[model samples]
Target: MIDALHTHRPRIVVIGGGTGLPVILKNLKNRHVDIAAIVTVADDGGSSGILRNYINVVPPGDIRNVMVALSDLPQLELDLFQYRFKSSDQFFAGHAIGNLIIAALSEKRGGIFDAVQILSKMMKVDGHIYPAANEPLELNAEFSDGTQMSGESEITAAGKLIKRVWVETNDDSHKPEAVQQVVDAIMNADQIVLGPGSLFTSILPNLMIENVGDALKRTTADIVYICNIMTQKGETENFTEADHVRVLNQHLGMNFINTVLVNMKEVPPAYIDHKKWNEVSQPVKHDFAGLRAMGCRVISADFLELKDRGAFHNGQEVADELLNLIGRSPDEE
Candidate 1:
């Protein structure tokens, strides 16, 4: 079995958004593994949403980030891809150079996926980046109090308890190509990783796609979840570690995940304050006792670290832990 597994490196499918997914991709790029990043396309804010609305393209912010993370380019080229324009003009201000490039390509090709393919070829990205859906989708959140909110930004800003989330679309504008690619990747993958990002906005939004969720349920891959280090104020205000798993199961169905990765290292109070993070609602401490009851194995490790202005998992450490959990000999495979 080990020899057969070694015949081909494991294929990995990582689903999420924002900085979190990119960080993971950056580390995994160096490994001899096949990777596919299925990014959330529900963003309707900032430059990405602006381009999406004006040009009718999929949000490129997350896609750009993933591309940069997986790019095999020189440091200078990587920096160039990440550069943003600083202008007083509200429209162009804060727009990333990569976003603009993607927007222009979308105009040239007349489709966002086409633009992404072009950019991927140019950057020589180590993995594939795909949008969760082709249609410009509005995220709808139904609160426990019977309140409905539209837009990911508004839902996160509402500070209300979300009972459930669904994509708002009249026609079946889902991208069949992206869906088929994800299904094929999942069917052949050895493992699938689901986020350490915002539960509602970044992670769950991708899984809410009907076909995406269906593929996940049918895939033979072992699913693993990386729990977030800190909770978002309006999103998961007082959620616990177990709460994350429970919520994920609610959408993807029960027994969907096989392993849960949690940060076991103690975070320094100084680092926490420097990052302006309020641990008032600290990470759901890995509910080892409770997780065992749910038939999920809990993998504890010191994967947590402080980076930029927030708490993050040390990419190297995270990769090492995950590789170990999957029984891959880091030195050999």
Candidate 2:
């Protein structure tokens, strides 16, 4: 089915981190699309955190996910990259094989971007991947009372309602190569997508990068945001659809987004219960009226695909909806 869609070779730039962006990219792989993933580097937990502390390297988990998503490699190679060493020792526990590969490449190239390029080529990836920043960035969050928490994991666990988030970087040097590649991809892209991940941590972190934000603001591509399926407890608890768009505007500024793709269907009660998700805590109901008030078009559909305890987007469904919204004929070259 996807093989036939690869004819037009549309250029797409998907921005975010964590597991979400890669899921979307996986669905888009080998289709008639040129994918360029711009990933957030603010993670400070587990293997990524350890690597960052010891070696001053960008968190490689997100980059690794992007690589695997776009890889046309054999299943064995993919599994090997995702392998994690299980050990009773705290120091050796939970480090992923892919993270080690990226760390090694960073050492070899003396830079993260070059190492990513080399890995991309080696994997026969269908698209490119860029870290939002070249240098390691520490995420800091200011609370309503002016107290600040440092580090991404700490910020998430701080328990104080976040007032604002920013990157800590004294070095003013920007990675021109990464920035240029992002801008080039954006300028040439048919579509640019954001989210389906943690709004502030995953999506906004990419936008927080100076050059990356500038490229997004200047891009002529049609923008679409895949709204999260559920409100994150610590981060976006009780946030409505309108609230999501509003926060994005607040952080990245107005009109940076054009359309929002929201899930508009029910999840099985059994699945929700099994996943232990509070029914009352589901994604803020799609507020079509409020979304329209924000001057953004809403593309609401039954995008839910229930697996285990969570509701996920059906990849083909999401891809088709995005293509339709952008006016691409399914049969068009």
Per-residue lDDT, model 1, residue 147, is 94
Q: Which digits, one per residue and each the tens of the lDDT, describe model 1 over residues 146-245?
A: 9998888888778789888877552446533345766677777888999868888888888888788888888878888888877777778777678888
Estimate the TM-score for candidate 1.
0.92
Instruction: Evaluate residue 25 in candidate 2 and report its C-alpha lDDT on the 0 to 100 scale.
Output: 90
In candidate 2, residue 214 scores what lDDT?
72
Instruction: Name every residue pair that clashes in candidate 2.
Output: 6-32
Q: Tens digit of lDDT per residue, candidate 2, span 73-176? A: 99999999999889875676889999999999998898788899999999888888988776677677778789988777777766666766767652535432
**What lDDT score is found at residue 48 in candidate 2?**
92
Each prediction's RMSD to truth? 2.3, 3.6
Top model by TM-score, which number? 1
- The ten-residue window of minimal lDDT in model 1 covers 170-179
TM-score of 2: 0.90
